[model samples]
Every structure is written in C-alpha cells, then in structure tokens.
Target: MSAPESAPPTRPPAPELRGAPSPRLHNEDLAPRRDAAPWRTWDLFCWWMSAWHSLGSYTFAIGLLVLGLTGWQVVVALVLGIAVLLWGCNLTGVAGQRAGVPFPVFARLSFGVFGANVPALLRAVVGVAWYGIQTYLASLAVMTMTLKVWPASQSLTAPQFLGMSALGWICFLVLWTLQLAVLHRGMEAVRKLSDVAGPVLWIAIAALAVWVLARAGWSVDWNYREGPALDTAGTVSAIVSGAFLTVAFLAGPMLNFADFSRNSPDARSIRRGNGLGLLVNGTAFVLVSVVIALASAEVHGQAVTDPVELVQDIDSVTLLLLATVSIAGSAVGINIILNFVSPAYDFANVAPSRISFRTGGVITAVVALVVMPWRLYSSPVMVNYFIGGVGALIGPVFGIVVADYYLLRRGRIDVDDLYSDSPTGRYWYRRGTNPNAIAALLVAGTITLLVAFLPALSALAAYSWLVGTVIGGGAYLLAERVHPSGSLLPEPAAVPAQLPTQR
Candidate 1:
C-alpha cells in the first residue's frame, strides 16, 4: 500500500522492507518471531483446553451439579456459560489479529504512546493474584498424592504455618519452581507444552469419569437432578444470566488474549483455534465434569469439585495415578501460559530496557512466594471475590478495544508509529493520554465492579462483563462523537520493499 499524503515526512533512506525478520519474541516482553502462528481455529481450541482442564476449572464446571438444579438445568447453565465465553474470546482475538501486537503493546493505542503503562501495571498485578491462586491449586493436587503415600502425615498434631501443612509448602515450592523453569524458556516452550498438556489432561479426565461411572454402576444423565433442585425456574431470566456468567468469569484473561494472538501469523488461525478450543472443547470438558461430579455424588453423597478429591474417593489406585499426572501437568501448563507469560510482558512494558524477561519472571516468582496462595483457595467465597474484583476490569477494556478497532481505526494500523515518539505520531493523543478512551475505561470499569461486588447488585454478578462491555463501548462512541481524534497518523514514508504485507 502506498503511503498517504498526510503520512509523516519520509525519513532519509525511507522505511524499506528489511531483509531479515525480527528475532524470536524470547526477550520475554513480546511475541517470539521464531515460531509461526498456529491455525486461528486451533488457537481457540487450545485456550478452551487450557481454561477448563485444570483443578480450579473443574471446581467451577461441577458447581452446577450441586446447585440443586435438575440435570437438564445443569446442562442449561453450563452451555450458556460456555457460549458467553466464546463470544468474548472472539472479540479479544480480533484486536490481536489486527495489531500484530501483544496486550501491553496494544494498550499503547488506547492508553496513548506513553500512557499505556497504567493498564499494563494493572494487568500485571492481577496476574500476580492468579499466579498465587493457580500455584496453590497445583500444590493441592500434589498434597493429595502425598497424603495417600504416607497416611500417618494426615494426623500431625503440630500447628502448621500459613494454614498449610509442611508437606503443602514443599509441594507448592516444587510446583512453583517447575513453572519458573518452563516460563523462563519463553513462549515457544510454553506453546508446545500446552499443546501436549491440554490433550493429556482431557484424556485422563475422560478415563477417570468412565471408570467412576462404571464402578458405581450408574449411567451418565443430563436429567439426573433430584426434586426441588429444579424449582428455581424462570427460564427467560435464567438462561440469559447463565450465559452471562460464563463470559464474566473468563473476562480477565480474555481482555488481553492478544498476548497470545499477537504471535499468530494471521487472524484465521486465531479464530479457528479459539472456536474449536473455547466453544466446542470447553463445552465437552464441562459435560465430562458434570458427569463425574454427579457420579461421585451418587457414590459419596456429595458432589466433587476437586478432581484429585474425586479420584481419592474412588479408591482405585490406577485411576488415581492417571488423574494425578494429567491434572498436575495440565496445571503446570496453564500456570506457564496465563500467569507466567503475562507478567513477563507486563513488567517489560513497564520498564522495557531495565527488566529482561528472566528478571521480570523472578520478580513475579518472589511475589507469588510471599502471597502464599494456599490460604486464598481455602474458601469458595474467597475465590469468587478474587475473581470478581479482577474480572470487573475485563469488560471495560474489551469494550474500549473493540470500539476503537472497528469504529475508529477500521482495522488499519501503522506498524512503525507504534514505536515512534514524535508529537506528530498518530497515537499521541492529548499529551500521550487519550482522555476519551481513558474516561470510557474508568466509567465502564466502575460500573461493572459495582455490579460484581456490591451486595445489592449480587444478582447481576453473572452479567458484570456484559454491563462493562456495553458501558465502555457506549462511552467511547459518545466520546468519539463529542471529542474525536483527527485521522490515525498515516504510515511512515520511506517504505522498505521487503516489509511483510500483514504486519
């Protein structure tokens, strides 16, 4: 494409397409160039696999099982939730596909050339919270296995530190260290590990579910809820709200999905990957989870949340071993991609030159150690609160980004100006702060957070993401009309012949 007349002055020696592609995105801050983008459809599938195939994920999936709802009700809620998640994932993917940049870098557009740091820091802080939570859950799986081996340790009389047994701490540190090793290697290793781990986890869960049902002499049913559980009828409201919860719970990571998508070679791969992974794969995983939870309830008189706990209840050594390896390994993969990779990019965004990938990763590791995650997972209320608080911010960002890309920029971006600091740069709005965008973000975030956290609005908890998305997107449109920026800065002059057409 030819540079527009309004584009910035052509630099001497013009922006010529360089002969060599950039080095792999291994410095820890950006997408590695070494690996080619996977098929878009595959990306979504991978996310779905990673999202639902974990210990914490199972807990949420089986939540409907014990909600006193009929089997059909449980299916209704789960399907609704998965659908919501798919929609949010789809929007998030588009931003990445268009920008060819990770989340933090993309923030440069909305937050301004220099003002992007705020959101980056906010996201990193949230990442810390999740890092601790997932780490703790992984340790729980380890503790479960250890208790089986040395039953006597279960009767320790001494008061333990941090509400955790000595064995728990050991396992936490072990798993924590393992995550650091894999994450330290950078994105390629994380991707390859996830591709393997997600599938392995699914297989193990399927195996465990089948074994449990066969042993219990029960058939899987989508209509097995006992009476009185299905009494909370009000179909219209229930279905809509149930669908909203699926997306709300997943809003946090979905907000910055570009962190992964930016590494892709194109948009099609991301769409395909997410569609298969998030929509299809997630629904299947949740179905298996519900079945297992129901079967376990029949056998033990209570629905199971933790996969390891379910495995223990069966008292089958072979099934237990399979569950242990699969769940633990899958947890490790998730920890690396979601928690570890994000903070590295976030921290780098904060101080690109000063903090290298490894240094930033170590910093996060220390913080995770200090938080002592196990205590947080001690209660369901705590997990929901933690999720609610972070999840609140997700909607506003999603709204703002979608509105900006589709309506304002129309999916076109100048690859060079993203790094330029010239006052004339297209993205340097209002002294490096896009007031309209910033205002929209704050307004949307406040509204959603209230919906999620306020006692009076507890009923709206599931719809928080939607509320924020609408508010943010609406606010931006209003602002753009009232206070729009001039056109996006034109592409830089002096185009190199070798520049790839896409990025």
Candidate 2:
C-alpha cells in the first residue's frame, strides 16, 4: 500500500524485426499473495469436475452414445481422448507455474508483447458469449422449478423481445446478476464454490445414474449400431471427430491455465493436478454419463441429453433429489469456472493496472445480457463453427509458448522484461512485436481454417487441433532456426509487478 519501489534504468532499444512496432518500456507491477500458490490434490481433481459436469457435457456424452458405437467403443474414445487432454493440461500447468501469469501474458512471446492481444481478445469474447448462455440456462432451471411449484405463475408468460418469454427474461436477468456477484468476489470465492459444486454435482449424477438403472432393470444390451459406421468406413472418422470436439471444449481452460498454475508450488503439483483432474476425474464422469444415457433409452424409448429431464421421468422422490442436485451444482460450478473465470482473467491480462479481478468480471456479466447468449448456444452449427475457429488458434499459441520457453528461451524468462518497452528488454522484439510468431500463427491458422470450412476434407475436420499444432509448432521452430535470436535474454534484478511471491 506504500509508494511502490522504482525500477532501474532502461536498457538500449533492440533492433526491430521486419514490420514490428516500437514497444513502450516499463516494469510490470502485478503481484499475488505467495501463500495462495499451494492447492491440495483434491482441489485439482475438482477442477476437471467443474469443467466436465455441465449441460454441454451431458449433451456431448449423449451424442457419443447415439453415434452408434458400442459401450466399450465409447469408453475407449473417452479414455484415449481424456488421456491426451491430461498430457496437454500438464504442460500448460508447468508453463503457468513458471510464469506466474495468465495465458494472455505468456502469449506475449508468441504474439508480440502487444500482438498477444489478438488471441487474448478472441478467447475473452468467447468467454463472454458463454457467460450469457450459461446464465440463461441456469435461469431456465430456476424458472422450471418455480412454475412446477407454483402453477399460478404460468399465467405470467407473455410476448417479449428476442423470442424470450417475460418469465424467461426475469430468470435470465436474475441468474445474470447472481453470476456477476459471485465472479466479482474474485478467484478465492470461485475456487471455493467450484470445490463444493464439483463434488456435489458428481454425487448427484452418480445417484441419478443408479436410480435410472434400477428403474430400467439395469439392462446391459447397449443396442449399439452395427452398420458400416460402426464396423469400418465411418469408425475412424467418428473417433477422430469426438477427440477433436473434446480438444475444442478444453481449449478455453488450457489458454487460461496459467492463471491457476501460478498458484502452484512446483511443476509436480501441476502434473499431479492435471493427472487427477483430466484423466482420472474425467474418466469417472464419462462412465456415469454413459450409464445414465444407456438406462434412459429403456425408460424413455430414446436417448436423453438433459439429466434434469431424465430425472423428471422417474416418479421416485430419491430420483428427483439426485437430479436436482446434479444439474444445479454442475451449472453453478461450470458458470463460475469456465464462463466467469476465463473472461475475468483475460480482462486483467489486457489491463492489469486498470482492471482488478472484480471489475473484469462485471464487464463479462453486462456483455452476457447484451448478446442474448441462449440463441447462440442453441444453434449446433454455430457452436461447432465458433469452437473450431477459435480452437484452431489455441494449438498454435500453445506451441509458440512452449517453443519460447523450453527451446528458444531455455526455460528462463526475465519476468520484468515481459512488461518492459525497452528494446534491450528480453521480450521486446522490434516495436514490441515478435514477427516470426505472428507469421507462423497466420500460416497455421490458415490450415485450421481450411479444415473447418472445406467440404472435400470432411474426414480431416476432427483433426483441426493436430493440424494447427504441428504446423504452427513446426513453423515457429523453423522460423527460429532460419532466424536465430541467440539464447534467451538475461533475467532482470528487479522483480516484475505480477511476479508471484511464492516462487
């Protein structure tokens, strides 16, 4: 709270890369509490729970079931896909632990110190959109419960703007307001909420699954599709598509991974957290999801995507108890973690000095109302396009970061230099931009765009992440080789403003 210590003399301006902009030189000043870095293993496990236990998650799981794959095949896809996710999360976690920053800050190396804004803004926009959609859905749940308990409220329905009924608007606004309240409280509150929401959601889901099985006599016939799609021609395509979708779902969290990782004590904590969260925790979630899907077929004569609806079919009080808890908890956990946290951190990344965590969160809440997110989320094609488009960029950005850290930089970063505008500062390439990274991102992003929009290569659509990652990574590595920048720049004596006290 006292006057901050002054930074040392500025370094000489480094020669600029072609088309690079001049950077503003200064020291970064964001520092977090040191004690917050250490999280328990269970906390890490719950992170995945928060990520996976949501309405979208249930829809994806049920889609897999309807894909005609046998239960065993679905299990294989889920296991293999999540295992890959575990590895990606571990690497991301390590980056976060070392940097003590969020995803957008680390992106400075891949994009220019300023160029990072492109990807950061892209991710933040998506986060804001999701915030609106999730808030709307949560409101729907509340409205449904309200109307059920008080049938007289049904008369409140009336014409409204944007196709939403008056009651729907009320619910949406109420949920939107509540989300802002929680998000404005900061990450500590988000963490505690997720910790409770995650475990409670899983327990409720498991109970719902058990009740469904008991009601349906727990049949194991599976009734998998036995045609060409399942047998050979369409098989590989399905698995690949499923995997790519999973990656896209993960891209948002992966981008912001550093926000959480900076709180970790060491790389091992990151590794442990990711392993439990992505692999073990994810596997268990998929299993319960599939069981519910399978059992619902016998009870309803069709697959059910909404667990709440699935529970409503059951007459038992026990079934209702489980269903209400699972859906509600999952919604809250996901709303806070994925929708709230990502955008809040992103806003901070853009202007750490100007925006505290709470202000950034409120911005997200207001934007959610303006967008009418429910309409956006309801369109499957739009969702896929949005996810695929942004997701293609995720791999390239991640690749660039890994290259800058492990390969070009030799695992060393002058944390203070990240914020400095001086040419001589470690990261300030001409005008504060990293031209090679920008070029590579453009090239790799092109490949992703092609895969997404091209009709001829439908088979390759699901491999968008792989294509972008390989192309982007290989391109960056080649750029570095063709135009070496010597070893990483030296570390500074003065600590960066955002540097973690723990490390």
Candidate 3:
C-alpha cells in the first residue's frame, strides 16, 4: 500500500454483459463489478494495507515526529488523520457497495456521462505525474541497493541520459515493466498481490523497528524532539497540521474509493475492512515508523526517515534485501493502483470503443515519460503548486458526487439509464453534460486554489479540502434547485425499481 487506489484493468475486455452502457460507451473494464462473487472483508482490508503502508508513509510518520510534538501528540495527530481516512473510505465505499460501479461511472451521476470523462482525465493526469515521480524515486532506492550488493555496478551510474544515470534508467524501466505485468492481469490479480503484500509489509515495518530498538541500547525515547519544545498553542497547531496533511494525502484515493469497493459484497464489510486496515493497521504502522525512525537516529547519529537509507546503514545483506525490496514493492504497488489503474479506466472512458484498458494504461506510462517526472519531483515547489492545484478539483468532485447521490437523488439510482444515452435517459443531461456540476466545480475549485496558493490564506491551507467539500456540495445543491439536473427522474424512489424505460 502506498498512497492511493483504483479499479483493475489493462487486459483485454471480457464478453459484453447482459446490462451494459451503450456500445460506444461500453467496455468490459468499465462494466459494473461482476456478480460472480464479492470480495471478502480480508481482501478489502489487505488493499488498504497494501495501498497505504509503504516507505513513503514510513517517512511521513517520521516527519510528524520531527514536528516537535511529544509522542502522545504525534499519536493523537496520526490517529485523527487515520480516522478521517477511515470515515471517508467507508462513506464513498457505500456508493460502490450499493451501485457496483467505478469512480468514472459513479461520477456520471453528477457530472453527466460525457462531462465525467474530463474529471476522470484530470485525475488520470495527476495520477500519471505522481506515478512517474514515484517510480523514479523508487528506482533510486533499487539502484542504491543494487550497487551495495555488487560494487562493480557503480560504473553504471557514471553515464547519464535525460538527467538520469544508465543504471537509474534500467531500474526505472524494470519497475515500470513489472507494474504493467501485474496490472494487465486486472483488479482481481491486484487483490491477490495485496493479500500477500499487506501482511509482509507489516512484518517488515515491525522488524525494522525492533532491529533499530535493539541497536539503540534497548532504550526508547518518549519525546524525540527535533527542535525547541513548543507551547500548547504551537503543539496544537503542529498536531492539526500533521493530521491535515495525512488526510489530504489520500484525497486522491478517497475520492475514487468505490473503484476498490465496487468489488466488495456488503457495506458491513466496507466498514469492517476500513476499521481494521485504516484505523488499526494504519495506527500500528505510524507507531512502528516512529519507533524505527527515532531509534535509528540514536543508532546512526542522525535521524533517518527513508527506510531504504536506514536499512543500508545497518550493514546487513539480509536486512538490506528484505527492507529495500519491500520498500520498492510498496512504491510499485502505489504506482499501479493509484497511478496506473486510475488513468487506465479514465483514458479508456474517453473513447471506450477505441481504447482498451491496456492502451489507456500505456498512454499514462508514455505521458509520464514525456513529463520526465524527475524534473517534476526535483522541485518541491512546482510539485506542490501543480499537483496540489490539479488535486483541488478532487474534493469538489467528491462534494458533488455525495450531494447528488445522497442528497438530491436520495439514494435512488436508475442503473439502466446510467448506461443509456437516449434522449429520455435519466442521466442524459444537456449534451450529456451537467452544467451544475461544472459550475459547482469552478466555484469550489477556485476557493481551494486560493487557499492553497495565496500567502494571505496560507493558514487556511490545511483545511482547504474540507472547505472545498462544503462549498462545492453547497453550491451544487443551490445550482440544482435553480436549474435542476436532467439526471433526476420525474418519479424516483429511495431504491429505484428496475423497470423497463421508454428508450
């Protein structure tokens, strides 16, 4: 588990199902989750563990430690953050559990069929950018471990191409290829991988902590402060900021959570899995990360947040291979799930008849290469400004989706019309796009960017996602009242009947 989530696709499409979208909009990859069987609670739980418990997450926990909060404060912030994530995942998971659709299809409920494609593409672009940047970062770790094992390979790092060394390029491509290999197997394949990787990552996280703790003379520092002690106000601010970033960190995955949840059988499983995976495992890793990072500082004479770097300092081949390989796998998992899978379905939706899931994913990889993500990752400012700005829309989109489904429609859904393009279709808005959603998006997204980028509003930056949700959902609700959406049926119910439509 790394940072985000998505539905699985990339292989060739399956045979068309009984009830599906119009042919032009149809693709096996975009169909509702198969009814053959639903995923067990453990399966869903494993996904969160595999998707989130990664090297990046480990370093993030260490960052909270350095914020000068006491151990208890750090724990409080982490628990709060993970709790918010749990609630969001469970909330969004409901739509998928009840509807059995991915994010793009679900968005159609609010954004309109054709209009939804743009939002999907927006998410795809962000996913691809992060994918490339993360891939490059993970490759560096791989290359470092490779050189540590075989000193002779140092020569491979001497030559440079496009700002990356030869060895870096090789490692990057290999990882890139490996993700594709697993992804082309589809969502179920990813589930199997997560099932194993989740628990193994937990072992690796705990093992690193234990190893570091032993080396630090079996001593534990309750408050591993990195700076001057903060007063209550400063302490509260730090905790809030940390928790804010933690929740914001998963905004991408949280919005499209149904991509994963669609396969789940029941809402109860969603809640239970989120509880175990996010609240329990997420808290465990945060605490473990704190111990490993703080203990490493005592052992190595400097705080080491990066797990790969910390493991390398340990000077044991066995530990090096285990930690580094696991770290790399976690990064790969995040890239595939959040980055690859998102764009795969998004790109496929653009022209379903023309592009298969594999083609869409290939496009994402290609564009990631074109962006040369190293450059993006090189500047923290640019990464934050661009990615953050692009990501601003996500919260607003969530606002609209929740408002439309849970409020305006009152949980009623016309599944057939969701797939229909007929003039009389329930979801067929003006030209197959929802102006209200577009309007609400601009309203909320503008405010998010203002909060994120404006110096005067910098203090409010932490709450930008929450602000977006309130404003976006509110604006869209108002807009619907003034100019109602065509998606709303003349006669609708809480649980819509599967009656034949005029079209």
Candidate 4:
C-alpha cells in the first residue's frame, strides 16, 4: 500500500525545555513517523530472504555441518535457533511499529536521550566491521571471475597491500562503489532490489544444488563422519552449539531489526515475515547448502565450504560466470540491507541535526575502508576472537531494550518525552543519561566479551550471546526494581491517553 500523505511537520518543544536548536534531541529523520509505514508482510519476508541468502550465511551453514551433526540434527538446531531470533525480532518489531521510530530513537525510551548514543555507536561500529568484511567477501567473487576470464590478471597479486592483492582491491572498490550507489537511492530502491534479488538468488542456488546432485549422484553422505566421531553426549553438545551459532550469525541484524520493523505497517506483518523468512526459508537454504557441500566432497575429493570455489570448479564458463554474478549480487543485497542501513540510521542518531542519513552512510563507508577488513577475513583466529566478540556484545543491548519496553514500561511509551529535555519530561533522566541501563550493559557486555575472547573460557564462547542476554536482562530488571526510572513507568489511570502513532 502507498504511504499516506506526510503530516505537517511538528516542531520540537520550546528552547526552555529542549535547550538550544543546536542540540535538539529530535530531528525530522529521527522523529515519530507522520506518514503510514508502507512495507507489507511479504516485503519483510523478502527482506530476510535477501539478508539470509548470502555467501557468509552459506559459509556459516557449512560451519554448522562441519560440527559432526547429521543433516536432521542441524535442521533441528537451525529451527530452534531461528525461533529464538524470531521472538526477539518480533518484540523489537512491535515496539518500532508502535513508536514509528528507528532503533536508535526507540533506544531513547530505555537508554535516555543522550545515553542512547552509547548503544547506537556500539551497533554502528559493529556494522562498519561487518560491512567491510562482507564487501571483501563479495569482492572475492569478482576477483575469481576476473582471474577466470583473464588469467593474466593473476599477476596483480604481486606485492600485496594490506594483505589484499591489487586485483582484490580493485574488485573490492568496484563492489563498494556499487553498494554506495544503491544505498544513495534510499529505502525504496533497497526494497525493490531485495524483492527481486531474493528470488533470483534462490533460483541460482537451487540450480547449483541440482547440478551438483546430478553430477555427484544422490548417494552422498548426509552425516559429518569424516572427522573424529563424537559420542552421543558430544553430538548433542555440537547440535546445541550449532543452534547458538545460528543465533550469533544473525545477532547483528536482530538487534537493529527496529530499522526495518519501523517501516513495517504492523506487528503481525513482522511476525509472519520473520516466521517464513527465518524459519522456512532458512531451513530450505540450509538443506541446499548440505546437499551442495556433500556433492562437492564427493566430486572434488574435499568439501568445498566456499560457494565461489565450488562454482570455480565448474567447467562451463557460462555457468561459472552466472554463479559468480549471483554470489556478488547476493552479497551486495545482504551488505546493504544488514550492514549499511543500520549504521546510517545509527550515525544519524548520533547527531541528527549535524548528520543527515546520506552523510552518516558515507561516513560508515569510509570507516569500513579504514578498518581494512580483508586482514580480518584472512585470519580464522581474528574472525573468532574479534568479529565473534563484537557480535556477543549485542546481546546486552538487546536485553536492556526488551526488558525496559516489555517489563518496566509494560509496552507504553511516551512519544513526546522521547524528544524532550525538560526535567518534567518522563524520559529526561539525570541530564539525559540513564545510569541504571548503562550499568547493566557494561556488566553484561564485559562478561560476555571475556567469555568470547579468553582462552580458558572459550568453551562458553559459542553461547556468549545467549548468556549475556539473560544476564543483562535480569540485571536490568533487578536494577530497575531497586532504583526505578520513573520515566518508563506506566502513567496514572486518570491521565488522558495519547497513544503513540500506530503508523
């Protein structure tokens, strides 16, 4: 459905309460929506489909299979893990739909106006990291195709810069520019691209799977028995770890889900979309990955975890070119939807008056380049320690937001106070900071990080997201009970209702 006509813009409160126009808490970009959200339930489903059907997600599925679980066991883990993720997404999605605000703005309800920046910046930094990593991954496909068509291009590998070959840098920059172009067109362009890309990539993947099966035969082993065999107890632990990793894989998007959810017209749409996108679509994709991996091992004498490599094995240049393009397109689709958009909104929220959405996105792109994520991608140790650690931190913020919205506030948010700096404003706590929330985040995040990084505690690292979320949420509940933040408390029964705008 078309969005309704934009309502007349509402001005921020007077300077006495809102301070100078220079530091105004709310701006047009961050404000409650004046027009109806246009996204339907199917749009949300396609959104997840686009996000999930990436080389990185496929690699992650391969990682789960490598854990020695049977195909059915892996499916069980994925279903359970996705259900947990869906629950979290639905909770935040409801809040976003009801408030008609982005994730960072919605954070103000719990984190206070100024304090909201903490979580916003944390999430933004993570996005920048993932953005670079994904861009690098996408570029690899271009590099592979380049070398395939022009073997002479292989000479570009001499004297590598920042651990990347000249050809790799060329491909990375090319894909990076392409992503920026798409992002510049804004959300409508993104929605349209996702709607097309998801289905196209699905067809490509299905074709590849069928070809692999036809060549390798259907007798491929479905169990991961090539490595050391695990006993029943070990097998069960591996399955559970597979489930935990599934949640970790999508943890970043799940936290900033409000970015998309706010654009959704209703909570039911978000729920239905997540169910199909994550549960059903995710399962089917996992099955395809398993079939392709088993076939690759049977045909190539080794399991090809990387889809690009598997495609490179194809003798037909036409098929190889098509597969490479599909991987590149899928990478771009996911990187934009998951990595680029979150930080754009987040950095804009950092100083809405100073940073426009486009500028924030540009800033994110530059920072992604500065991180030189190719180095991170090259090292498995760095991947586990650094990228994994950052993902674990998201759990704490997620817990705090969910707890405050559902438990403390009981699903009621005062939209006006979310922008107000007045002492009387419900959300204006202690010069715009909520110490209680910050405390919970730090405590929970620190412990999770330790578990994720420390060698001695590595056994718990895989489940850090789950552990941190529970601890952070429980801590917030306890802290609020002892030192209540009246801002999030429910209003008196006699007070006139001014419910947050549904659209």
Output the lDDT of residue 107, model 3. 84
RMSD of 1: 7.2
Candidate 4 versus the native: TM-score?
Answer: 0.91
| Candidate 4: worst-modelled 10 consecutive residues by lDDT | 494-503
In model 4, residue pairs whose N, Cα or C atoms come closer than 3 Å (at least 3 residues apart or on different chains), thus clashing, are none
RMSD of each: 7.2, 7.4, 5.4, 4.6
Which window of ten consecutive residues has the lowest lDDT sum in model 1? 494-503
Cα lDDT listed for each candidate? 0.68, 0.68, 0.78, 0.80
Highest lDDT among the candidates is held by which one? 4
lDDT of 3 by residue, 63-125 (tens): 776778766678789889888788777778877667777888878888887888867877887
Model 3 quality (TM-score): 0.92
Please report how far candidate 4 places residue 235 from its true position, in Å.
2.0
**On residues 1-503, what C-alpha lDDT tens digit does candidate 2 reach at each position?**
11211432222222222332222322132343244425445566677788898888877766775556766667667777787677667766676666666677677755656777777777788788777777777667667665665668787676667978878888777767767777777676777777678777777777777878997797844554334346675666676667666776676777677777666665665676677777778888888777777777777776677765765565555545456546655776787787777777667667766776787787788777777777877888876688447756777777677666665665565555556556775666757677888888899888888886799976687677778777888898898789865425455432222211111
Candidate 3 Cα errors over 4 Å, as ranges: 1-20, 490-503
> Once superposed on the true structure, which residue ranges of model 4 sit more than 4 Å away at CA?
1-23, 34-37, 489-503
lDDT string, candidate 1, 7-73, tens digits: 2222122122223322311133553222343423444466558767877677766664444565556
- Stretches > 4 Å off in candidate 1: 1-28, 31-44, 65-68, 152-159, 226-233, 316-318, 379-387, 487-503
Cα-lDDT of candidate 1: 0.68
Better of 1 and 4 by TM-score: 4
Off by over 4 Å in 2: 1-34, 226-229, 232-237, 314-322, 485-487, 490-503
Predict model 3's lDDT versus the native.
Answer: 0.78
